[model samples]
Target: MSRRLLPVAVLVALVAALTASSSPAAPRQRPRAPSGLAFYRPPARLLAGRHGSVIWSRPARGTLRLAGAKRALVVLYRSRSLTGTPIAVSGTVWVPKGRPPKRGWPIISWAHGTTGVGDPCAPSRDSPTSLAHGYIDYVYPELSAWLKAGYAVIQTDYQGLGTAGPHPYLIGVSEGRGVDDIVRAARELVPALGRRFAIAGHSQGGQASLFAASIARGWVPELKLVGDASYAPASHIADQIKLVGAFTAPSPISALGAEVLYGAAAGSPAVSISALMAPPALALMPQLEVKCEPQLIQPDSFGGLAPNRLLASGANLGPLLALTGRQNPAVSIPVPILLAQGGADATVPKPFTDQLAGELRAKHDRLDYRVYPGITHGQIPAAAQPVFMRWVAQRFGRR
Candidate 1:
């Protein structure tokens, strides 16, 4: 390493870590290696080919009084990695009273959407501006409702968020692996949350739920999934990127996300980011991507990533659009698959979700898809929880 450039690289790495730590688009964190103890390690493929099976654990339990319910957050987790490197994975299992509930509990895998680096970005800071305006976003309201219904809520932090290692972005296998590990952990924790779990999530989480349901059929012989309910999942990342990427308007947030994706891709051997793009685009990434607060993000920052980069990545829409089969079909499910979308969502296009559901119906079993006429991305789950809760009850055959 060049002595003159060493300080600058260190500064950049520090700034990147701090910048990522914050963000209206905040993320979670893990224990960093000791200060001044630096050794470069490349990204490894941790969760692959039946990934979660290799990293299952006994459960971790904690108690917290929340929303008038004496709920215990049982974490179904594992700290081992499929990559041969140690990685931590965990989920918050909110078990209602009666220490696992007498009649046992139906599993509700509470999936969360994208938050950039897969880490819990910022806590409840004084959102005075938005709070004053009476706005509440991403609180996982289902936790309260599911608890009241005597269902155990298993919310996964996924692999990268809070757990150690570089987040494998949009990689269903890894996320799904994390989901499977947690579910297995949950079943052992209470012993009542056995098989036949109902999966639910929004955006990125929705996608993960699909992957989990698909894998439960094979990898997790013990787990029986009855339904998969996804809300505006990024079923088509390539297309969604194209849809959002159309906002020719310049936005730093967009650039940063693209930058991260590129970095992850650059960092990912499954899909090469550098091989997909030419020099200037690849070279301009560092300069174009970074932002201090990430207050506003749009489509433009993702320019060099789209049209070609996404297509070349081999996961482009072409295959996802025409997907069908048992492992992880692109469409709905063989069992009950409920897909709800907010028509006004600016992020994951509702039309794309509709198309995905339509494709799934051709070879899928039971499926229900609803599009809230005027709702936006954030409002979809809030509006449909009543119906979702009932659907979940039905899936578990809850009388």
Candidate 2:
């Protein structure tokens, strides 16, 4: 049997106009003045503060605001890297209107799926009407729903997306810690916010949500993690890499394969890029560090290459495989979990999620797994919105 590469069109459509440039015919605009990117650069002294403590925060300007949010804030906070070293993370917090329900608004700590490893891909930098809006638009309505339902939402940009470190993409511990710590940062920023929160995410975020659920009770004991809701969460990453290694033709998912290699190498000292990547792939690595997903997946980029071509011939993948295998979110979770998958999702095949759900079920891990018949990967969040929102609400003890 042969593996079928995902159609490039599908991947392209999912990130439409992500790398498109402004028309040359348009009037020349003035170069934008310096902005708050400096906020991401935390002072050295602040790194010594407690993890999850707020370093600094300001009002979320322009399009960073959620539709139903009464107030929004851009925040930089302390968090730990995959190696337990202290790092700064940037994110946004949105508060609901007319709060004060005894203990204050419960939180929904949101983990977003892949945009890219680049700083420019950070969601906090997105305007509702900007080119980057394509990425935000997918989840904006869903986030607005949570805000409207009276849940305050906090979004983490992960370790390196908008911060000053190599993004340990798909490295579970780093991503999960960011997800968990941000909830604490939110509570610290807004004293009115309740300590209760439910971790929810899509794709990469879904995986992070599971990891966050597993470690929240221990990592941030001060806060209460009610449950986890993952929509088409990424799983079977090691197996996927093996499949990529076997591909002999151009693959739309090659960019993701490249990202996996980059992330694995960045997160662990034992995994070396020179030892794992082929010359062709190695030549393109600088772009991977700076380009967002859309640009990285263009035909001229990783998208035009076969996955096997990305790996050096007879490259020892053992270390890389072991590192990624550790990131699978199939382990036992300390809280109730709602795992939803899309039958039509090519990015994360149904069988992969089935195995993940099966593993958790075998552990009697308080799991609620659902499969939507026709939903694609990008559609899972929207398709499962009603169920997940209700599930999150139930966990928080609301209607």
Q: Highest TM-score, which number?
A: 2
- Report the lDDT of model 2 for residue 66: 77
lDDT of 2 by residue, 1-399 (tens): 223545666677766553222101111221222356887786676676668877778788887887999989988888988667889898999999885688778899999998877788888888754434576668989999999989999999999888897888899989999999888788777877887889999999999999988899888876778899999888889888887756888876888888888889789999999898899888888887667776777888898888889888898889998999999998778789999999999889999999999898998899999999988998988999999878987898887
Off by over 4 Å in 1: 1-65, 74-76, 79-87, 99-103, 118-137, 241-245, 251-270, 274-332
lDDT of 1 by residue, 1-399 (tens): 989999999999999876543211211231232221111121234322222222222223222233424445423244334354445565566666656544456677767666544233211111334221121234445567777777777767666554455555556666676676666656555555545577887776787788877766665655667888888876665444445435444444354345335424523454455554445345545433222113223343343333333223333433222221111327435568888999898767677887778777876557798889888977888888888878888888875
The best candidate by lDDT is: 2
Candidate 2 lDDT score at position 272 = 96
lDDT of each: 0.55, 0.84
Clash pairs for candidate 1: 26-121, 27-119, 27-120, 27-121, 28-119, 28-120, 118-161, 196-224, 255-301, 331-360
